[model samples]
Target: MTDLKPRKMDFGFDDADVPFLWNPENPAWSSMSNAVSFLAVGFEKMIVKLIRQAKPLMTDPAVAEEAVAFMRQEGHHSTAHRQHVAALIRRYPGLQNTLDAVIGEYDLLTEATSINYRLAYTADLEATFTPVFKLMLDNEETLFRPGDDRVASLFLWHFVEEVEHRSSALILYKAVVGSELYRMRMAPSVFAHVLKVIRIACAGFNQHVPLGERKVDALSMFARHRAKQRVLTFFAPYLSKGPMPRAFDGLPIGEQLTALKGAALSQTPGHDPAHENLPVLADEWFRRYDAGDDCTRWYTAEPAASGANR
Candidate 1:
């Protein structure tokens, strides 16, 4: 049986006044995570279409089942993220253009790319989530706890679920395409496209959101951007993006390096996401969720208040 379960969540993004800087303590993290919300919507929309196209080609019953469940999960994620993005757009209407542009990139890819190439793209990107999400989940106290409860809870649910089905995309890819070399060959382009989408979202943030609200450059998450900004500050201040701060400067450098190494290894041949180290928070989140905790308000929910709906 497929272990992936699609959990429906309403983060009350519409009811509350969602701030652009949701985590005032870490505006850069808030900005970066907002970009992630934008990326998730477009990327998961592509996943839904990709899986639908691949469904008929899936000969193995198990792989078919996994694909169906994975598709359902991703569909729910896309819906939830759309809500988040809608809230942001309600606040900053110009972001609608940004969302359209991001989705347009994936739409173009679907039209231009082959099924095998799309499968490889999905597999290559999803394989890195186990390690990348672990680094964030492991430091949830700093990365999530201080953020707006709704936004923080949204990411907590999303990341844990990403970890839960970490291997699904690769399994589907291997079942259909079955070319490790092809997957590896596609990694660079897949990641480049991902980064490009993120850049679009960040640049939109800078253009649409005022510096007084965002407090730092939206592109601060990129190390290369920071390096370039540092040189510009010394040489050409007029061309610099304002106040390049990192989303993860508080995180341990070793943990960050480990995540980077793990991400690199994930693209190589014969890498199994099932064998990757998991975050302790994923297990705890599952336990709480299974126990009927109100995960939509992860921090405020009382654990002792049992029998609440998931």
Candidate 2:
């Protein structure tokens, strides 16, 4: 993993003209993903604030700077997702109301919950999402093959950064609470809540797709099966009190950031997020992203329609 400061590369989600079911071949995947984007808008904001709250507690300047960089990346993420969601609202009409309610729910939680609880929630959620993103990265070609490029690129970029900053919350947790046991204890509740939110989001997304399209088919069925296996592989160890295996070491660095517990930060005595040189694939991708090259065509601008509805 590279230790460079996070850069805010806005992928212009506003101008993109994407269908409601961007992945025409797999509306289920598209719906679930849309739900995630809806969650991102508010959830990321809460995470950014939570990270900033831990700034004073961070003694290492490098970690502190990473926190700041993480905030910027998350801020841009929220902005891009918010724009995409607004477009969805325009296309689906009723989506705005559903998402508004969800954001409002987060608002209430933020207001009533203690900071430590919020931080714990953020950390656990990050841990939960780390493996999920790894799965997506692992199966990108199959899942995204028929999806809209703009939407695919948006999520790809988001997941890449998700891998990039996988350790930020853990580092912050150590700085503030200094207890892995607390995190372990909090895991069940956090995972339960995360699942509930995803269910709600999927329900919202499902409403927008036609019933015929929502039916299960060979491709979607296979996708779901693979997705389940990846989830179990990532979480079974922790849940069963067994050894955690590093199943994602060979993935792209962007997806490998949280492969193990998390890439350790330089702020931590022996661990450095930038310890190993990045792989050629990731190093080149970041270079293109930084330079605003056409390699990011899917994200930099609106992409053409994905042929037709399935």
Candidate 3:
């Protein structure tokens, strides 16, 4: 009875000319989300392998079922994101190197880390998605609606499915590893690695993607990078990356702070993702999908009439 069913989606990323600045109105957000596409391919690939290895350790039948469903969902996500990244690489061939570096980081983690540690890593990261994705989805009017439909729809589908199975990773971790303290203790290192991978992808974007196309510093998603760039602008202008802008600058500060607080709280010892405030769009997206509204072209497709149900 696991509700974590995997939904396969093809966003037509193969159609020509997938721009790096997918969301022209929010170039910084475009850059950040593109980096996420790169990150997802590698991270989810690791998840597939991690789940396979951890499968034997799962004792309860329900936990095993949840783990398999979670693995399938993550597998679909990785495939879809690869299509997105492949389109980007086709446009900017040097992005191949960036993709390789990102995947290599995860490959190394799988080889170097223990199963318990990897479980902790997955649990820690997955716990934050509901809050972070909610912030993005809640403001989809600006963040997603104004973007290229294919890319936006791809993310919309992915985020909703993520919400659907928000607790699976932690559930598997608790079942197999059975240590909340260990997960909490490993949060710092886990997040450090996550940020490091994102930094690598963003740095590659800056080096490979032209400034005119990217529109802002690729590393602008990182607050520390932005602060350093600000200092460098006055002292050593040439050393700085291009102008640093935030992806969420247009979003209300209070909402951004709330999401930040939620993300921080997610790493605590006993946080439960099921209790977190969800994005309104998640329910809407599900309603639309169940109503056959063609979520792969979310913006272009007509929504079902009001009061419509599956």
Give each model a TM-score: 0.96, 0.71, 0.96
- In candidate 2, the residue pairs with backbone N, CA or C atoms under 3 Å apart (3 or more residues apart, or in different chains) clash, namely none
Model 3 root-mean-square deviation: 1.7
Taking the tens digit of each residue's C-alpha lDDT, what string does model 1 give over 119-216?
99999999999899999999999989988999999999999999999999999999999989889888889999999999999999999998889999
TM-score winner, 2 or 3: 3
| Alpha-carbon local distance difference test for all models | 0.93, 0.61, 0.92
Give the lDDT ranking, best first.
Answer: 1, 3, 2
The weakest ten consecutive residues by lDDT in model 1 span: 301-310
- Candidate 2 to truth, TM: 0.71
lDDT at 263 for candidate 2?
Answer: 24
Error of 2 at 181 (Å): 1.0
Q: Candidate 3, 146: how far from true, in Å?
A: 0.5
